[model samples]
Target: MSTVTSEIPAVEATQFQHTPYYCEENVYLLCKTLCENGVADATGSDLFVVFISNEKKQVPLWHQKASTRADGIVLWDYHVICVQRKKESDAEPLVWDLDSTLPFPSPLASYVNETIQPSFQLFAEYQRYFRIVHAPLFFKHFASDRRHMKEPDGSWIAQPPPYQPIVSQDGILHNLSEYNAMSGADSLSTMDPDTVGAAVSQKLGVVVSHTQLEELFTKLP
Candidate 1:
């Protein structure tokens, strides 16, 4: 197993603001904060925003504080997180999931093992898919209108973040569905790592199966 040495500095997870049940916004804020902190500029650590769900919009994740079960599993419609790909060859990629009960800035390997659990078999509907967007592009192109958090009658499903809804740098509003959508055909498991990186960097994002999560980020250039 790889370890994060004390020589490596990481942003404390608590330094960022988090709102309950608003993972997408939370991650957007996280990416913004990282950029403002100049972590990416200083370390050349590529940041990626990951959306976890499937065609059915159901994803099972463990070690979630929101889980009512003793095993700490939550069946979410969709979830979002930030992944930092270190420039150092010896350093493992890190996952920042504010909603997870796992250690803050968990190593990608440990997060995958404890939270994603790719080895665990489940029904086809419960299978998890990932949408990875390069943080620079995600921060520039992403937007949310908060429509997903409202009931059909426009009531609140959960309290929203205090800040205004995010708008894209290009002024496009509410493109959350584009990022969250994952079709079966979008899986990049068969493609070479370079192709996966190209897809994520050039396109809005790329979707890969749970088994491909760690491979995709770890091998990214």
Candidate 2:
């Protein structure tokens, strides 16, 4: 039952990033800002910000694809989110998913256990779910450090100031607009996600399918 105050400014950072791809870092930065702003009650590890990753075919909420579904949907590649529980206050833990692309801030279990039907009634081509992984780790984007195994072979390329991190409200909004833009005039209007999924899978070198990660999901119907 924990809720955000809505007082802090998205000018610093946010989870609702609109990058064409690679949202893990966006989520991480957003969590960092939330922690700074005391989203999970005065920060610290109690906030329980963990990284969730899994295989996905198309980008849910954004990707364009064919649909026999009431809302034929697609999935995204590795995604990240924050989880926290205020035992002393709220009765339930809240998922801080800013880029949720859905009604957002959905219950953690609902986001985790819900199937392609309820989830896809809005956007899913078939009844199939993929495996998702949970890790209690925060991934780093900028290579400020972690530069190891660097021989004298000029292994590290020099990145200038912009290499730091781009945290801007305007920029974020632009990216979000670009990412969520979907209309008959858009390119996805002509692309078939089912057929394009194979190319996506091959390029990503990951197995993306219209199948269920669990038999339970497959048998739900």
Candidate No. with top lDDT: 1
Q: In candidate 2, what are the lDDT values of residues 1-221, reduced to their tens digit?
A: 22433422233223444342334445545556656666644433434433322222233533123223454343543334554544454334445555544334544445544323334443332223222211122222121121221347846333222234433333321122212222222111122444333222221111223232222111111
Model 2: residues >4 Å from true position, as ranges?
Answer: 1-18, 54-72, 113-221
lDDT of 1 at 162: 93
Number of the top-ranking candidate, with TM-score as the measure: 1
- What is the overall TM-score of model 2 with all chains considered together? 0.41
TM-score to native of every candidate shown:
0.91, 0.41
lDDT tens digits by residue: candidate 1, 1-221: 22574423566778998999889999988877877787654322378889898889889999998998887999999999988876665677778899988888888899999998878989988898888888878877889989989999999899999999999988988989988888667888566766776745664768888878877776676
| Worst lDDT 10-window in candidate 2 | 212-221
Clashing pairs in 1: none
Distance from true position, residue 24, model 2, in Å? 1.1
